[model samples]
Target: MVNCMKEQVFFGEGMAMVKRDYPDLYEAIVALNEAAYTGKVLDYRTQKLIAMGINAAASDERATKKQMISAIKEFGVTKDEIVDVLRVVLLTSGMPPFTKGMKILGEVMEK
Candidate 1:
């Protein structure tokens, strides 16, 4: 849950609000996040890439962009590594999501 909270800050806002207004729900969400993100066979860094890819595949522009920035800042995830992830997105999710992900990645890199 602690790890999840830190990541929530990294990826976006609203966690504090949730925690204040809905402590139980916030805890549940955090618990779920912790369970999902716990490094096992896959390292946490690789999991971040997979999460970013999932967001991109869903065409979630804001989440994808935030995740790109977070991964880069946290793990030194390179643009090339992101592009590799997007390559999988292109194949699995098709062009629209792939293009959107690429655009978001480009914007993040520029900044």
Candidate 2:
């Protein structure tokens, strides 16, 4: 399984720096992350895939790519599943994000 806490943090470089630069704030964020992922109903794998979709919808190329790769490497999420997520992105987020997400998905799957 992909150890998100270790392998690749979803947080950006600025946030990484924040971990050291602002310990209190960073700790709160970390706690929030843990709480959010505790998963009352949906499994972590499903939640992670949803997160990938959210990242894609947000048009964050870096985070989307990382999430996609992690989903595949860790949980074996299929290309079809990603396509389904992209369909949602297309509807709610527009073409740019959907297009970018498709591009990123292709790149990640090719490897």
Candidate 3:
């Protein structure tokens, strides 16, 4: 098997499309992204992990995997920490989403 993960994933397909077709909408989205990630109180890494967990809770496989990979590469986020986040998902999001999250976590971790 081979891992074909890319180093970066565009934050949102809709946003990217808007960026291509309508630069004005893209500007608003970019500003939002920048403001959202600014870590006024929680810090960027913590915010990223929260995003990871939220993505998992939402059963968003692609976003969860992207966050996992980005966290590991960008912030050295640990597997144990990710498992901890998934534990929250298990409680709030139920087993299926939690398991899906775990699967994505494993795949990204493996790569």
- For all candidates in order, the CA lDDT equals 0.82, 0.81, 0.77
Q: Tens digits of per-residue lDDT for model 3 on 49-69?
A: 888888889887877888898
Candidate 1, overall lDDT?
Answer: 0.82
Give the TM-score (vs. native) of candidate 2. 0.88
Which pairs clash inside model 3? none
Compare the candidates by lDDT and give the number of the best one: 1
Against the true structure, what is each candidate's TM-score? 0.86, 0.88, 0.87
- Could you tell me the lDDT of residue 34 within candidate 1? 74
Query: lDDT by residue for model 1 over 1-111, one digit each (tens)?
Result: 122323645243666778899999888887788777778788889888988898899898878987898899999999999999999999999999999999999899999
Error of 3 at 38 (Å): 1.6
- By lDDT rank, best first, the candidates go 1, 2, 3
Candidate 1 RMSD to the correct structure: 3.1
Q: How many steric clashes between backbone atoms does each model show?
A: 0, 0, 0
For candidate 3, give the lDDT of residue 65.
88
Off by over 4 Å in 3: 1-9
Candidate 2 accuracy as lDDT? 0.81
The RMSD of every model to the true structure, in order and in angstroms, is: 3.1, 3.7, 5.6
